[model samples]
Target: MFGDPIENPKGWPRVELDEVLDGIDSGKSPVCLSRPATPGEWGVLKLSAVTYGRYNASENKALPEGTAPGQNLEVRPGDLLFSRKNTYSLVGAVVLVRETPKRMLLPDLIFRLRLGEPQMLTASYLHQLLMYPSKRKEVRSLAGGAAGSMPNISKGRLLKLRVEVPPMSLQEEYARVVERLEQHRRLIGAQLHCLEAGLDSLQATAFSARL
Candidate 1:
């Protein structure tokens, strides 16, 4: 039911993504075995790190020493990560890194983007845009191959994609509004979970009394 309220908003700058951001690069695949640290010494993240527009750090794998640096992609907080190859349904999946523990690395299949100007393109706003369904569909349309196993949208193509930008102040305001909504949603979810658990417990007690 959410509509484009920004389309008609005054004082918003309608700009392409390339105009506001830079350093749209993909990660490289490190060699299977190299010198640095073993598989256990380093934390390696794959496409699985991204789920429902959030980064699940717990799913990350630990790499031991001797793993080549080139095999893993280097990413930092504020970078946007996307899955380059996936089925049509899952292609163009995006996640924004809120924070990363020291020396975290991403897998080769993920693309990392660093915003050129924090003021121009707020990470929170861009993260919301990346999770937008329309944007995901647009990216998926650019997917190559008939099998749909490798729906690869190149960095150049991604750079060329257009995005509407609002003023920094407005973006920050919007982010705050979104954050409040998310908080409310989480609260409702928690209440639902508690009710469900209570019901289960009551059912178990009744069964025991009958026995």
Candidate 2:
């Protein structure tokens, strides 16, 4: 639910984060009662599961036998996750969930964003914007708590955070750019793996010769 919408300039539209998001809710905080789970067991997500630009569902540990996985705790693909509480630097760390394996429930410390209008802003574009260095710095500065322990951004502050919203067309273009960049990244990663293997073989041959 958005507050009173702000009028935009002639060209670029600006909106508070709440304007574009339908809801922001954290998950159940069940006590960690068991070790990390196998592939099919019910599990609880950890704060570490939400990394910048990535999600590791495997970071979750198994729930105890009697713990109830609360309603609305399941994190589906395409959900945007934010760390509401963590060390100052890690607070507000966000990630796009690309996949969910088996039954994984969202943990209390992580908040999920429910988009109000997908057409107005693609998830990719908003994700890129949030992870932008300037925004990240702003988020870190806003987080509040004790000196050494977990800092937190209140839900009110998060909703009030302002964001620039360009035209939908421009946002789509940016999404395409992100897609291409990801493709390029995967290609480069494969090439680097090959190069590393080649180097390892060369080192092995050199060691054999010395022997």
Candidate 3:
């Protein structure tokens, strides 16, 4: 139901990213084991988890055995995550967490976006708006770093950047549509996976049987 973000046919009020935020919460980086977290183990979120516009809960490293979990840094359902530092092209990546595995915490390079006005700015809609190709371009321009290093955006710079905010009703509607489309995509992906598996099995049987 939404048009190209930059078009702003709805002509919603525009504001800086921080205008609707109480404050952004950043997590700390801690030494952790290389393996993905096993059930019952606490894990630190990897940057890949929030990259490419998808939240991959499996993309986390286990905390070293017995390391106290950072309770406050845990990723919550419905939290909108933002990558504030990364390679030039991926620095501004963002994702919305639908559900999360137990004990997964945010890392230093990522941010949990906290909305000051949840009534006005829903995480689902904000996630959709931020990932637009046009919006990515604007966000990337805010990143800065020295030569040969990853680009990063300071909270101050992000606060100064502008974004258009549609009315709450339209934003909520957009979120619902996006969720439905996402569900459809996942169903199709599952069907394709099943088909591919069946194909592989049939191919294996045929080749082994010399039919």
Of 1 and 3, the candidate ranking higher by TM-score: 3
| Highest-scoring model, TM-score | 3
Q: List the RMSD of every prediction in angstroms.
A: 5.5, 5.0, 2.0
**lDDT of prediction 2:** 0.79
Q: Per-residue CA lDDT of candidate 1, range 157-187, in tens? A: 7777776676678778987887788679779
Looking at candidate 3, the ten consecutive residues that score lowest on lDDT are 1-10
TM-score of each: 0.71, 0.79, 0.90
Whichever of 1 and 2 has more lDDT, that candidate is 2
Positional deviation of residue 168's Cα in model 1 after best superposition, in angstroms: 1.7
lDDT scores in order: 0.68, 0.79, 0.87
Best by lDDT: 3
* lDDT at 143, model 3: 94
- On residues 59-120, what C-alpha lDDT tens digit does candidate 2 reach at each position? 88888777777756788888889998887777888887765786888888998988895556
| Backbone clashes in model 3, listed as residue pairs | none
